[model samples]
Target: MSVGTTQTRQGLGSRLAALSRIVELGPGRVDPKLLTESGQLLLRAGDRLKLSADHTVVALAGGTGSGKSTLFNSISGLELSPTGVRRPTTARAHACVWGLDGAGPLLDWLQIQWRHRFARASALDKGESRLHGLILLDLPDHDSIRALTDTEADRLIQVADLVVWVLDPQKYADASTHRRYVTELAGHEAVTIFVLNQADRLSPEELAECVADLNDLLRREGVEDPVIVTTSATTGEGVDELKTVLADTVARRRAAVQRLEADLDRLTLRLAKAMPDSGAPVPLSSIDDARRIGLTDALCDAVGVPAVGEAMENVYGVRSVEWVGWPYSRWAAKLRPDPLNSLRLGDLRDEIKGLTGGSVSAQAAEVDTAVRALSDGLTVGMHEAWQNGIRDAARSRSAELPQLLSDELSEVAPRLDRVPGWWRLLLVWQYLLVLLFLAGVAWLGTALAYGVFGAGSLPAGLAVFGEAASLPWVGLMVLSVLGLGLLTAVASRNFVMLGAGNERDRLEREMRRRVGTVASAMVIEPVERELARYNEFYSALRGVRG
Candidate 1:
């Protein structure tokens, strides 16, 4: 599709509006300060567009002594400005609208109170319709005495779809002009024309040399292919060529948008580079397992139930059996509640809460610290593994792999605290209770009945009950108590192993999560941030180019 048709159909004003909304959504996403300045400049320029079905505005701009007004007069075939040998000739901007019905809206949009309209002299020589809606602006020098004049020139330069930058032979290589304006506007260089005006003053050789020099300078300034036209208002050299270029530019409506889109694309590419690659899965390790097991073991200890079953039975073995044999055993069991069987996960959770501190924030901090440590350790381990793998792989390639691995491991290792003493105590208690309860059950049954269901009198039953009640004389009772103690010691050892195993598994999971978080923060987040920064920088660079 033709550029003009696309631009006419898809309003630049609407695009600017959408961009404004996007900027609002993430104020800091694109560097609000830079975006704000850029947006303001772009929107202001967009607002000044003199929309027409068939016309394009081309504006000329430059610093004082750049001969912009002289160029304007040469192109329009009319004396548009009062020119002199003085540095600042035009104080106010002048517009020459050709073959347009009225200049009311156009002039109003440009904020121009003075305008001159012209038509071709004859039908046969009619270039009027071809130049229909064309408004040629002779703006005041951008480096003018009046700040407002310079401001207006800048605004016009931004608004004009095509810009003709008039440069004198001497000032063409001005550092301020090149650095502050030319280099910055790399993105918009396509829509820009760098004309070395006052070319008639230079000798043929000097003119050629000057043009070559300027072209080389522009290339260095990042204008890949800049058009350098030599012109003189005195001789009108290259005037016709300049006119033809302008007319063609006007005909191709897509030029401006295409230039702008290219600039945006360049910025997008830079942004993509700044973004980090999403590869490599976060790894899991054993240290994380240890921390989790330690925490759980600590929790079990705090709940006073590392060996809950044995502890409960040891503490109330006789009572438990009496209650079990009673006619109301079912109700007794429900009311009294065996501590081990009646154990609530909530209670254990609460104990964990207490150990970590009752506050969610506190627990979160503890968990975070523990998890972070584990993650760091895993990262270190992974780095070491990578180093070893690299060395093994590069045995056929290089010798620096081991050193690289060491460096990587050092980078990843996390600072760790010694396991808390309470954790060990908890593990010990957990085992002791389990053994005590198990032994108590065995001892109680043996001590209470020698054989299963033997013929017995009330005296015999009373004797058995009496003996069960006595702690010293009854052999079964003495043995059961001794067994309970022994079981406590034995069970405590097993509970420690079980607690360690459980903690290790939990820690492994926690460590994996921590590793993932670290990877996201260290790798992914930095990339995203860099991408955003580059995008904004590119946008600004492109804006200057234009």
Candidate 2:
């Protein structure tokens, strides 16, 4: 064999190994039958190639009465293959070897009966050493009446290193079912031979027309550089040309490798059709964002975030009132509930243990709809597989979703757990203001008591921390203090309500972010991993064909 051809086969062997490994890693990604068939073919061909490096196994295949047996006998110069018009003449295969040194192991593998095989040197001239190491097989008629004959022909055809299809002048230009085999072998042009057998029956002009017509059929099948030769075994005409062609092929010693390579190409192409046409996929719009929003919305509903926000607003207002409102109203403020305490977010696991929260169906359905939309860009089968993969990814941790969400909420509760220090300052200031009012009222009561005992009429001259005691000034001081305290209470209520709004908005943003993380880690990552594996398999298919 030429060094280049040997190198090509070695490269192909490496490609096959890589493809086998990828198939092992990615089971069910393609059809199981296809995988098994390709793998078995690879192992079988590898074993055959290793058994004998020099022997070229060429199959003489043809339909009924195509004169292939006569041609086979003519080539071997012996009556080894049965020939006649008794319908199915050859039910099994007959092998002829030019040299006897190593043909036994190969013929044994081919399962040719010992009596059927012959040594070419014993029958043909001894000068035919140029065709040494040639394993020529005369296979049963592919269109034989006996089912076993046809089955044997098919089995031999698959294992043979090269195939020479023998055609007669009569059927050369006519349409026949056997022609389909030649057409399907377009990729095997390097290892295929088309012989116009029984050429002695036709005139020179008729021969030209038949060969031209057959050439056209080959061209249509994409068999560029097709090998077409004419021979007549009965008249000993053009038989040497066939022998010379076989000699040249055997001398080169590359037919077996070429045949193996062609088979790999055909199988690789068949398997490649299952993958995506393009390697670089236009990314499907990510549902990660939408999914995050959906999940966060669900979890927030379960945790009652909106309800908590409202409570927070009320708690803020209540605390504000306690800090700066009327003394009696402060006690009323103590009766209201604190929003944070009701949420049970602090040590939330034990607090909300029995909470049977769940995800909403509408949200999950929307996610499913978006995922199916991605399939519009893919073929039907690939789309189905992708959809199934996505469902598997999502359901990986489906049972833990609620608990995960609740735990995540607890982890984030600290963000909202706070009380402003300004409320304390307001409380202290409120106390001072109330004390001023009480002091004024007490001083007025003392002066009024004196007036009731005939000293109260002189109340305007009463000294009360000033040069003169005046009811108007004292009453104004008390009223102003009360009004300032009411305004402070109002301001505190608005401030606390504003804080509650800000807290809700902030928590929503963080919650959505957390939801996105969970979805990606548990779902999106797995789906992308599967996609990456498929891409690798596609690349491997290209390598195997190359």
Q: How far is candidate 2 from the true structure (C-alpha RMSD, Å)?
A: 6.3
Candidate 2: segments with Cα more than 4 A from true spot: 17-37, 100-105, 121-127, 148-150, 268-276, 279-407, 410-440, 451-513
- TM-score top scorer: 2
Candidate 1: tens digits of C-alpha lDDT, residues 67-111:
788788777766767788986888777877766565566567778
RMSD for all candidates, in order, please: 14.8, 6.3
TM-score, one value per model = 0.53, 0.75
Best candidate according to lDDT: 2
Off by over 4 Å in 1: 1-25, 41-50, 101-107, 114-129, 148-150, 262-364, 367-546
TM-score of model 2 (CA atoms): 0.75
Estimate every model's Cα lDDT from 0 to 1.
Answer: 0.53, 0.69
